[model samples]
Target chain A: DTAVSQTPKYLVTQMGNDKSIKCEQNLGHDTMYWYKQDSKKFLKIMFSYNNKELIINETVPNRFSPKSPDKAHLNLHINSLELGDSAVYFCASSQDLRNYGYTFGSGTRLTVV
Target chain B: TQLLEQSPQFLSIQEGENLTVYCNSSSVFSSLQWYRQEPGEGPVLLVTVVTGGEVKKLKRLTFQFGDARKDSSLHITAAQPGDTGLYLCAGDVTGQGGKLIFGQGTELSVKP
Candidate 1:
C-alpha cells in the first residue's frame, strides 16, 4: 500500500485560476506537511500540521492555504495561481514533528500557464 | 532562516566510481537526515544521524555526521546506475516545531 498519496499527479491551469491539491497518509503519523519543490529542485517547507493543529507556517504567501481535516489528510489550496506557482508539491508525514525522516507522497506536478 | 549549503549541485560519473556529497550549515542541529529522490517522486529517507561524529552505513552508502552537528556527508562506494537520483540533507534545530531545514540538494547521475 502507498503510505503517502497525493491526488492529481499532474495539473495545468491558466494564470489567475485557483486549484487545490489533496494529500493523504495511511502511516498513522501525527504530523503532515506540504512542501514546494522549485525548478532548481530546492525543496522548501510551506506548512505543517500536527494532529490537525497548525504548527509550522513558513514564509509562504497568504494565497496558499493548507487544511487538515484530520490527522490523515492535508490539502493545499492555491488562490489565483501564478506562473511562479509552477512546481512540484509534495506531501509528507512523520511520526514525530522534530524528526527529519518523513514518508513523502509521489508529488503533484502543478503548472500555471 | 537556517540554510544548509550542499556542494557540487550536479554530478555525473561512470559506473563503479566513488563519490562524496557534503551538506554544511552554520547552525547546530539536533539531528540530520539524508534522503534520496528519484524523478517524479518524493524523497525517501536513506538514513538519519543524531550523535556527533556518528557514522551509519546502508550497503554501499556511508553517512557521517560531523562532531559539531553542523555538517554531514554521504559517501557511496562503487556507485551503480541505481544510485542515480537527487540527494537531500535536512537538519532539525531545537524548538523549531518539527520543521526541517533542507539543503539545496545534489543531483547525481550515474551512467553505466
Candidate 2:
C-alpha cells in the first residue's frame, strides 16, 4: 500500500498548454505539499497546504497553482506550461507542517516541449 | 530564507567502501533530517536528529548532529550497490509547524 501517490507518473506535453497532476495520501496527515526537482536534482518546495488551507507559497510563479480539496488530497495545476517546467514533481504529506520528515509520492515527470 | 549547504555534490565509490556526507548551515535549526531518494521516486526519510551532539545509527549508517545544531553528517559503512542514491539533508526551523530548508544534495554512486 503506497502511503502517498501521485497520478500520471509521466507527462509529456507542448508549450502553452495547461496540465494538472493529482496527488493523494492515506497517512492521515493534515499537511500536504508540492515540490519540484530540477535536472540538477535540487529539491525545492513550491507550495504547502494545511487541512485544505494554503499556508506556504514559495516564490513560485502565479502560473503554478496548487489546490487542496481536503486533507488527503492536493493537486497542482500549471497554466501555459513552458520548457522550463520540465522536471520531476513530487507530492508529500506530513502529520503537520512542522513535522521533521514527510511521506512523499513516487513523483511525476513533467516534460514540456 | 534559511539555507543548508551540502558538500561533495557527487561521490563515486566501490562496494564495501565507506564515505561521509556533510550538511552545514549558518542558521541554527531546531531539528535536522536526512533522506535518500532513488531515481524516479521522492525522497525517503532515513532519520531525524533534534538534539545537539546527538547520534543515531541505522544498521550500517551512522548520523550525527553538530553540538551547535548548525550541521549534520551521515556516514555509511561498507556501502553496497543498493545504497546508491541521492542523499539530502533538510533543516526544520519552525518550532511547531514551519518550513524546511533543503540542501543541494549529494549524488552517491556505489559500484559493485
Q: By lDDT, who's the top model here?
A: 1
lDDT of 1 by residue, A1-113 (tens): 89999999999999999999999999889999999999999989999999999998998999999999999999999999999999999999999776658999999999998
Candidate 2 at residue B102, lDDT?
89
Per-residue alpha-carbon lDDT of candidate 1 for residues B65-112, written as tens digits (9 for 90 to 100):
999999999999999999999999999888777788899999999999
Cα lDDT tens digits for candidate 2, B6-110: 988999999999999999999999889999999878999999999999999999999999999999999999999999999999998865345678899999999
Q: How well is candidate 1 docked (DockQ)?
A: 0.83
List clash counts for every candidate, in order: 1, 1
lDDT, candidate 1, at A74: 99
Best DockQ among the predictions, by candidate number: 1
TM-score of chain A of 1: 0.97
